[model samples]
Target chain A: MREQSRGPAFMRILYLEDNPLLAFHVEQMIEDLGYVSAGSLSSFAELKEKFQSLQFDAVLVDIDLVDGPTGPDAAAWLQKRGIPAIFVTGQAQVAARHHDISLGFIEKPISPSDFAEKVELFRSRSTGS
Target chain B: MPIVILLDRASKPELVRAELARSWPRARLIFYQRPVTAVELVSGVQSALLVRLRQRDVRDHIGQEMELRRELNHRVKNILASVTSIFEMTRRGATSLDAFTDDFRGRLRALEKVHSAVFHAAEGAVSIGDIATLTFEPYRLVGQERISFSGPLMNLGRESGTTLALCLHELTTNAIKYGALSQPEGRVTLRWSVIDGVQPELALEWKESEGPLVIEPARAGYGTRYVRSALAAVFGRLPTIAFEPDGLRCSAQGPLSRLSATDSSQPR
Candidate 1:
């Protein structure tokens, strides 16, 4: 089991999930695991419009959004900006196809352990450590 | 060359022979009347029809199976996601293992029962009356009825019904935990109706009364948040959940078209 706390550096996570319940649930889990929740947006469009103002260490994206299946495009966009994006989705196959853009994929119904482990990768990628 | 022509008994053999002779010259024309065996013809036609029917049945079954598979995949993923959320929320609220188990199981059972009702509904749509009765059924005693629901005949499509069910579950849970249903004298009333007009509108309300003094929580929890978000998603309008001194009252209204299964188009 991962320790409850990882020093002072709280990784701020921005998740893109269209489903409001899942978004809220994951948001709570993120906080419970001692991470900062940057907030959640339902569509890639919202992310693009609000990206610059939001403060976050990395992103967790779902494949399908309110607008369309633009999770891959969002990941690529974040990658171009030097931000690490990890996919959290039920469609693992679709996320795998875009592996070059994302740090990795966390399959949905995300357990706290799996999420905490994979989310640590974002920290390493962001800090170049 | 001997040219033999079998003509239907009803047809003129002479005319058909002339036509055949015109097409094929230097032919000794030998004409034979077509045999009329009704039984043989009927059986032959019946077998052909049976083969075609079997082919159609197989084709339809394959198509239906594929469609059902797609729907099942979608439903399973959604249900899993919901269950995960319920588990997380219940864990957050629980103070002990028993509490966690009780809360989680109750929520899950509510979801399962509501889904079963919606699925088994013959028309693929469940009326609001049925939703109310089914949702509150587990809580009711054999003789004493503490909770009551009244509503006009209003049907909801699958998505809307599920959303409503979840919201109702949250309300029912909250009532049991802290509001009306927490005490023997406490009571809950759920009422709903649709007002007919150029743009029909649906109105629903849940009221709790004769309970411990209602104190609004400092912050909204999973139940309130879920109710707010789910109702807004289905109705295109957010509901008002007020914690009054007397009791808790939740009310919402939106276009009826959005809630009904037959019509999903948003009112313009």
Candidate 2:
């Protein structure tokens, strides 16, 4: 068994996804990357609250949340707080708008391989070492 | 000819001296302040000419609007003609009551759904989600318990959405009648991919496992033929189909440009 790193050695990820099944799958993917899923929130309110309380290395947000507000709105809030976020959306048009603001985009049904690759990319940029 | 009237310092004396009311009674007049110098006079003439040109521009605009309206009417008529022809052909080909009703209603709904999507989409592009929702609404209602969908959100060009929706509907119909949705335990996996370096293609897998074992039909029916033909018509190319022991697998590949064109002149 691979030894688990105790603290900040593993990247901390804050993932906001609406679908429970997809959220679980993504959380598992985040864990497999030797990263800690700081927390996963489904609603905008919870996501905002978690962001305020936690120090996440990066965030992966979905475009359409089951609740009201959009993923970009959450990303914009994170941006105001100086946190880096990438949009994980199935909608190509929605992703296109993030060309200027986001770190990058990950298209959905959230393929395991694609999710892992994007997480690694975010981790590299956040550490910069 | 339209009359011109000038009013200026030089003309002021003439207007004051002459019978102003009588001279202008029946004449259409344009008034201008008199220019002090030769250069000013030339500039006044140019300005007067520009006003006449502006009037001509208004006339031209009216003419163009008429032409546009005519073209729009022509296009609408053509769309109706093509839709009528398709119905006629389908009616002639359909043998039984069930086949005719299924094919007719399915095709009409497909056309209606596409029309609605195009109407709503602003830049000739519709969200893939909208297309999926519209096409699958009927199936979802009919097979509420059986079928489920999972995929990344993707948008296709408005015209492409229409084609994609129709193709999906046809596939769903086939599954409902013979494949997965026919049984209680079976399901479909619908997914798509957009690779950066490669041409964008949509892959939809209809896997029907843990249900009744599917035996290949002795011969392809009108339902199968219509599904194949409709997909071909949309892509403007032949689609490939594989008969697996588990379920039916179909793949379609084509240029995105062909799929994206929104010109209604193109046949649906």
Candidate 3:
């Protein structure tokens, strides 16, 4: 890791989960971990409408969304756009199949420590550490 | 033409005076201790009354629209949370890659199936038999006679119906895998009866027989867990699942009144 400073500045994250309730719950956790929750959307279509204007740093996605199980495709789309993604899912085994598309995974019913550590990993990956 | 009107100083003149000046600038206006005539005084009061009513109507409309939006947001959140919970929990039992994908997708479809049934009902309630029929429809399309569903038209609340659908999904899937539906000669009988009283209760059973010999799994899986967890909340009772030599037998009973809904706040 490069010279670690208070240099890992807070950045905005986009949430891609079909459940609005989970999104609302996770948004609180994101803020608590010192990141801004850019916004949440259920479908890839909604994400497309939002992504351009959002200017977010990273993404946390679920495997199943409003548009069905289109989450892996969303992660790939984000990767192509030079934005990083992490699969936040209960189906870690399923997410592991698409490991190349995302920076890492954060299992669901998220523990604060795991979330903090994984977010740090995202921070490091984005900051080129 | 200039519509000149004199106002009484004590008759709440400032509001009307300012509004008139903005809307009809060329008109002359004067405020006096007393209007020169009662006609002008009455006229000014009437205009003020009209503005007040209009303002109130606008405020009321805005308030109502905002309330509707809030309600929509809340329902959307609840559904999302439920979906997330289902997805999270279902992953526990999947074995092969195809099995995981198929199971998760099937459960989601079950939820969707119940959602539509709830929507089609006139009230935010559905019939238990309706739930059974719709769930068993695909099977029927293939050939409906193997499974027999017998129940009177007893109302079910939307949420309870959803839970019941999920349970039926587990029951149906398990039957196809290991119980009655596995063999050509296998069969299932689903029936429910309402015990009427001051506090009504519904008694339900799922009995499968004549498939391959029943062998109990060493461990419980997603479908079984889903049935146990969802019913604990929906019916406040844990259902019994048995591995009889003939087939699997599942049964449960709970207060019927909770499943009967007259709620009408569902957004179409």
Candidate 4:
């Protein structure tokens, strides 16, 4: 296990969201929670390239990315790489489908507090605390 | 010449034939007993009124078939026109890659919903309930807790149903993107009623609340234009849209007499 820290943990996150307005809000929330956003991608191709080149502690994905197959597709790709991932989706049924592989789901228009809590949970798990 | 043939028993056949022969000398008269042999009679008189009746029946059947074929073709053409309009609207308005995919899917789903509703109604007149249910199902999956509906069980002709279904789709999509469905705390209410006895008019209201404060668009978008134009063509009246202080509201009204149904034409 990595060494645990009392302050915000240093972990890299890759986010995949298509909507600019929502993406902006989510990115701000991730920063406020004191986690590093390694890179945020809007398309499947970009997501794959970023995942292959860098090591991300966790990934936050939206199920309905306009150009890509879906959030599940990204999650499945990350799963193949043995990376932890969670879906932030508006569709309940889609989230349910990924229950086996995903860490959890965060509904859209994500609340700031809820985001922080999820980030902390992911960080603790990543460090094996 | 128009001729009448009556098949009855318990009457004098010879006397009736003699009276008919005396009444009109230019007319030919034939007699048959009870349980008449239709084939024998037909063979006996090649130019009999009964043969003419059979020919007329066949002609009427063919005419009705032609009329039905024409009506079906007309309906198919109208549906194609509506689909084309939606495609054109999406093609012209799509800007980015994401926008293009989302818009295309939304429009295609709208067409599918409309087609399903019409098919379920058996290509006849559909009910307002059918249109509402079909158009709202997709949105309900996303915003399950935010939407509610109330309306009488009323039927609309196929044309009216198609038009109203399209409008409902546009409204739902707008709500998903910019209005009530966008926020977790927001709610949308849909209600409908009828008015005016002679020429019955249907009115539908869509109200949204508790969402992000809405600002009226400086200019109407493609969706707004499509709704206005399509409803005008279908209803022969302009739809009313108001961006209220709380949220957005739209009302659409149209005459009910234009609806087509097999029975119960009460002029209202």
Best of the candidates, lDDT: 1
| DockQ score of each predicted structure, in the order shown | 0.21, 0.01, 0.05, 0.01
Q: Which digits, one per residue and each the tens of the lDDT, describe model 3 over residues B25-107? A: 86445454463667866776666666667778999999988878955764665566566666655554567779888888887
Of 1 and 3, the candidate ahead on DockQ is 1
List runs of model 4 lying over 4 Å from the truth: A1-129, B1-43, B46-58, B196-199, B258-268
Q: lDDT tens string, model 1, B1-268? A: 4444556879997788878889888655556666946665565556656666777899999998886776567557867988988888888877899989988888888888878988798666898888888888877762148888898888897767876887888898889888888888999999998888999999999999999999999988778877876675566566899999999999999888767743221111
- Candidate 4: tens digits of C-alpha lDDT, residues A1-129: 235643453677878864432443455457667877664565565676555566677888877553433678878888887777888765557787888778888765465566677777676776677
lDDT per prediction? 0.79, 0.63, 0.74, 0.68
Q: What's the chain B TM-score of candidate 3?
A: 0.82
TM-score of 2: 0.51
lDDT of 4 by residue, B159-257 (tens): 557667777787788888888778888888889888868788888788999987988989776666666655643444567888886888987787766
* Collision pairs in model 2: A90-B153, A91-B153, A108-B152, B5-B30, B128-B155
Number of backbone collisions per candidate, in order?
Answer: 0, 5, 2, 0
User: Which predicted model would earn the best DockQ?
Assistant: 1
**Worst ten in a row by lDDT for model 2 chain A:** A1-10
* TM-score of chain B alone in model 2: 0.71
Q: Give a tens-digit lDDT track for model 2, residues B99-129.
A: 8887878877877887788777787677666
The worst-scoring run of ten residues by lDDT in candidate 1 chain B lies at B259-268
- lDDT for A18 in candidate 1 is 65
Write the number of the candidate with greater lDDT, choosing between 3 and 4. 3
Give the per-residue lDDT of model 3 (tens digit) for A1-129.
344553544678888875443554566567768788776766676688667767787899988764556889999999999888898876678799999998789877666688888877777876666
Best candidate per TM-score, number?
A: 1
Which residue runs of candidate 3 sit more than 4 Å off their true CA positions? A1-129, B1-43, B141-143, B261-268
Reference-based TM-score of each model? 0.65, 0.51, 0.60, 0.51
What's the lDDT of the predicted structure labeled candidate 4? 0.68
